[model samples]
Target: MKVSVLVITYNHSRFIAQAIESVLMQKVNFEYEIVVGEDCSTDDTRKILIDYQQKYADKIRLLLPEKNLGMHRNFVNTLQACCGEYVAILEGDDYWIAEDKLQKQVDFLDKNLEFTICFHNVIIFHEDNQYQPYLFLHNQPPVSYIEDLLIRNFISTPSVMYRAGLVDNIPNWFYEQGMGDWIFHILNAQYGKIGYIDKVMSAYRIHAEGVWSSKNRDWQLNKTIKMLDTVKSNLDGQYEEIIDRAIQFYSQHLLKLNSIHQGTTSKFTTNLPKHLELKDINFIVFPDWNQEEEHLYQNLYCLVRLLLTHPENNRIALFIDTTKISEEDANLCISSILSNLISEEQLEKNKNINVFLVGKLDQIQWRTLTSFLKARIVLDSENSDALLTSGTEIIPAYTVNQLIEFGLIFIGSAKPYKLNIGCGNVRFDGWINIDIEQNYKTVDLVCDARQKLPFDDNSCELIYNEHFLEHLTLKEGLFFLKECYRILKPEGILRIAMPSLEYVVQKYMSDDWRNQEWLKYPEYQFIKTRAEMLNISMRWWGHQWLYDTEELYRRLTESGYINIQEFAWGKSNTPELRNRETRVDSILICESQVLK
Candidate 1:
């Protein structure tokens, strides 16, 4: 055969027909065949290819796989199946516009003995947006080397035709990388120079499903850098300077992109809101003038109390200047603030509270830094009392000290509450159900129970968690127990129900392991042997630490609990905490109390 047009498609039912027709319309004098590797697509793309194969039986050869081989495997297998001396690529989502696209590329490679690959410019069409179509490349050189290609992949896949058998042994690393066309071009270009036809012959479509075009900017850049690093290592520094330059260029851009995404204003400045209205009270906590770490914690604690007390539509914004500290320190500070003051559950449910990190406070126009928050007042340390600004709309600003004083006066009036931490879909009628994820409908408050509980000391009447303690590590579990102890009032009960390690061991020793109903869940369906079941139980469901009655008693005692007791499944002495357990198999239940 003179040429073989290679087309690999998956889930491109809408555009497969056009791609097939483009190859058929090519006016060539030599014998050519269209080779299509149709991976198992969930859509009708395979059906379309089968119909085309039947109609053009002699001209088209379809290699349909029973299962999806993914893009890289399909491309490699299809490329190896080409019997012609030259191969032309046309992806299912793209098509050639010119009838003589293949003929011109074939003629050029045939005459130019030194050139192994040839390509032309293509019109890029954005299918999902209103962007006008443009050429993929401009002012193209007639001939290019591997060094020029190393800078970037400027060649469009649909417009490429290369001499077959140039890349006989594909590299194993090529399959691991996200890019295919660029690596293939690099492999082929190593044998000879790349010839550019300079004519716009094909149309490259960019849609939501297009693999390379669908990825975000950061992913694309990072993937490119990874690909280049692999090339650099595989080639053994054959083109180190060129590849290093390319890697550096992509790495710098990636850093800047990440900085911008993290709300860093080092490279660019963001405009502050001129005015905002709040339905309830708005508290804007300014940075400590002295930048004292202790003072920052005090302010955050005050804000957390304010949020818990008012549970109405109250808003609080805390500003942190990150320019004074390194990025790592800034991140540590933010994590400390969140893990100590507000849980992720609180941040998700109460969207009113915000923490803003500014790269430089001097760059902002407003005296206070507020972004994407609706607030009507500013709370600063300098302002002792509410100060009304002389403007079109007078906004009130209060000091943190005054807020603390106000909190001290009203904090005692708040009612005591019961908590159900890590409550996954098992909610109590009169208790506040809390979990890390907000997707659970029964979760009343979305916050991490592993973090500090958002409540006043000795204000909780009861605390309960079932099958949730094992999910935390030993250290984390201990810390969480102490948090529970701190929040519960004197003589307040704390109950915990979780999987019993002793029960699992007993089941493993006995012959009734296969009869356990809990192993039948879909997650444990892979357990075919007794050893697998025993191993999976300890590691599955994000389980970090398992406990028995003895270990449970020790843990509670370490967390400063008194009068620890063991109970049966769904059995608690306290009336409010009774019948709360849902799982009964291999379960261990324990209860303790906090005494001052």
Candidate 2:
């Protein structure tokens, strides 16, 4: 074959037909075949390519892999399968505007022996119409060298045609990079000078699905720096100066982006087109007309203070005009302000404090913000000035229960409540279920119990947990027991169930129990030896420390609990705590009472 056109596609069902038709319309004198590598698209791209292949069997060929090989591997495998002396590149999302695009590049390379690769300028078409279409490059020279290409990638993939064997010895480092086209151009340009044809032959489409165009500015710059580092390392330092200059350029830009996102510099306000408004917020240290750095800081401080002081059930909506500032920067600024203005104890006390960051307001966003303000208004309509004021007396006990039922107030119930700590999927009625992971719908409070529990002193009536203590280390378990003791009222009950060390050792020592039903459990079935069984029991399922009866009793006693007692499975003297154990076999159960 005189020339081969390489097209690699995945999930490009909408544009693959136009790409294929453009290749078939090429007016060339010599033989050319369309070699498409369809990497297991989850869309109709494969079916469409199949229909085209059946219609044009002699001119088009398809390499359909059974599974999805990612872009890098698919490009490498498809490039190797090309049989032509010269190869032209095109992506499934792009197409040729000029019918004689292939003929022009082929003629340029066929006549010029010194030029190993030939390319031309193409139209940069924005598929989303977010930007106007324009030419890819301007003021193009007739010839360029490797040093000129190393500074940046000026070649558009769909506009290039190169000698097939020039890139035969592909570098090992090429496979490690996330992108392929730029490095491929560099590799092919190493053999000879790059020839340029000043013509717009194809339209390079930019859309949400386009691989490189879809990434954010930060990701693109970071990837460019990483690729340049790889090139500098593998090329034996021949272009070290140019590559170092490019790395420095990208690194400086990356630092600026990070500073902006972190809100570390005061110059960010100058970049804003208009003064950002912190709407309906009080405690302004400076006048609203001033847009100084101190004004921004004071507003942020008051915002954090407002969020911290409000009642947990009250939804206080604070809207900021984020036309110039990104939502990410807004969130970071709030976090920075909170860390600077509030004490850690204040944050710990307000564990349920929530501050939501939103972008520039649209119709839906405006409605959501208004709804939050309306809810807060309905809750505090009688005494609007009482909001965000600390040290207010709690409501009378008679009305507290009624207010809690409506989800309007949470002042630590008048009656002592129960706790189901580390309650993963197995929840008890009338108890507040707490777990670190919120994957289960049963979890009512999703804070780490290792930290201070979000309950007041001498507040809880009963605390129960099962199959959870073993997941914590001996130190964490002891601290958690103390936290429970601190929160439980006098004569309050604390119950725990966990894997027993004695049971695991006894089962491992006994040879006859290897085929027991518990051993047939899915996680234990893979154990072929008794030692493996022991390891799986102690080390699996994130188990850090397993306790025997004596160790658990000693830890509870150390944590200031009296009346420590052992109980059988599903057995508890307290009615609410009874029958809460989920695992029946090879477990230890214990209960204790706190006496002040």
Number of the top TM-score candidate: 1
* lDDT tens digits, residue span 1-596, model 2: 99999999999999999999989998989999999999999999999999999999998889988888889889988999999999999999998878898889888888998998999988785675433356779898999999888877889999999999977767778888867999999888889999999988888888899889889766887798889889888888899867765664454345344433555333323332242322222111111212454656664565456445555424333333334455676667777776764574355544544455434443323322232221221110112222212101111111223323322223223447688888877776557777775422365555688889877788788999887788788889999999999999999999998879998899889986485556653323346898887876776557788999989999999999999999898888888877888775537999999999
Off by over 4 Å in 2: 263-596
> Which 10 successive residues of model 1 have the least lDDT summed?
385-394
Model 2 TM-score, all chains together: 0.45
Give the RMSD in angstroms, all C-alphas superposed, for model 1: 20.3
Q: Could you tell me which residue pairs clash in candidate 1?
A: 345-446, 345-447
C-alpha RMSD of each candidate structure in angstroms: 20.3, 21.3
Superposed Cα RMSD, model 2: 21.3
For candidate 1, the lDDT comes to 0.73
Model 1 TM-score on a 0 to 1 scale: 0.46
* Structural similarity to truth (TM-score) of each candidate: 0.46, 0.45
Q: What is the C-alpha lDDT of each candidate?
A: 0.73, 0.71
